[model samples]
Target: MPMPRRRLILWLATAVISTAALPPLYAQTPPPTVAAAADLKFALEEVAARFERDTGQKLRLVFGSSGNFYSQILQDAPFHLYMSADEGFVFKLADAGKTVDRGRLYAVGRIGVIVPHGSALKADGELKDLAAALKDGRLQKFAIANPEHAPYGARAKEALQHAGLWDAIQPKLVLGENISQTAQFATSGSTQGGVIALSLAKAPSVAKLGEFALIPESWHQPLKQRMVLIKGAPPAARAFYEYIATPAAQEIMVRYGFAMPNEK
Candidate 1:
């Protein structure tokens, strides 16, 4: 071979070797993380597992009270999506320009009163009966999520007030940080009973511990759970947000005891 031609061939071989030594560009892409309400823990886990299986993209979930999650987002927590137990929180984030848009209402929750298994309480449990139980000392303590932070807690309080028992049982209330923890308070026997989300009450773990009474809808405003992509979310995050509203995910939400939101 001519000297110049041989030198060019050598340069081309070196370029090929260097290109082969470089890492794949897509290997560096990160998974999206979502900050969700604690009550959504089980349902979201199931949905996320399916999402990963189908798309090869993982979802990292951080669960807490909606109020707490909102505060974290304000301070720039590293989350790509937010699912709140109340639409009000999502709207607050959107109004403040922290969320991508107005948000999508994914579920409507019902509040309930739960008692530990074998507590000899009848299935037809009522707030009045709970008040009576408390007044007579048959039930010394009751658990509820903090009304200041949890939508379920607020609804529980409203139900009690509607039954004219709020002040009567205020002193006996044990406050949990959020709906999931409040369910724990009752199921773990830390408290004799609790007011919690119906979704939590329906969980296998919770069902084994007790029966729950659905709080009358007239007692409180609808519990509309909403989800939104965070402002500046990447494409993967936006895709996950859309995936959650698909029929498959909606079915899972219903099976987990969430009602569909009323159509506008």
Candidate 2:
């Protein structure tokens, strides 16, 4: 070959080798971290595992009370996604310009009155019975999450008041930091009973430890769980948020006793 032709071939070969040695244009990156409500621990774990399998993106979750998590996010907690048991916190973040997109409702949760397994409590247990139990000294202690910080606790208070039993039971109440911890109080037999999310009560851990009654929906407003993508969230985080609203995820939520927003 002529000199000019050989030089041209050599340049092309060098370029090809350099490109191959460079980092992959679409190399796999580590998955984003998500800050989620404690009540969602079990269900979200399953969802996250499934998401990893389907999308090849790992999920690192940090679970805590919705209120606490909200505070941390405001302090720049380094989470790419946020899932809250109540919509108010998500809206708070959005209003503060902390979120990338409008917050969306993910699930509706039911509140319940829970007692330890084989506690001689019958189904359809009413607030009157609870009050009578407390007054008669049959039940000395009751548990509820802290109303000032937990949405479940707020609902529990509303239910008790609506039933005209809040004032009567106030002295007997022991507060937990969050619904999961409140359920822990009842399930661990530390208290006679407590109010918790139906979804948490239906978990395997709770199922083995206690039974619960669905609270009357008329007592409190709907518990609408919501999610938001952070302002600088990566594509993977947005994709995961979208995945939570898919039919597959909705089915999982329903199986765990969470009501789909569109369901009657």
**lDDT of residue 224 for candidate 1:** 89
Q: Model 2, residue 211: what's the lDDT?
A: 74
Q: Residue 47's C-alpha lDDT in candidate 1?
A: 89
How many clashing pairs does model 2 include? Answer: 0
Candidate 2 regions exceeding 4 Å error are: 1-30, 118-125
lDDT of 2 by residue, 1-264 (tens): 556988999999999999999999889767798988777878888888888888888878988788888888898888999989888999998888899866788888888888886553433446666867866777777889898878889889999899888898889899999888898887787787888888887788887787778988888988888989988888899889989988788777888888777631
Q: Which ten-residue region of model 1 has the weakest summed lDDT?
A: 118-127
What local lDDT does model 2 show for residue 196? 85
For candidate 1, give the lDDT of residue 264: 25
Per-residue lDDT of 1-264 in model 1, one digit per residue for the tens? Answer: 556988999999999999999998767567788999988988888988888888888777888899989999988888999999999999998988898798898888888888887663433445777866866777777889899988889888898888888898888899999999999987777677888888887778788898888888888888989989898887878878888878888888898899877652
Top of the candidates by lDDT: 1
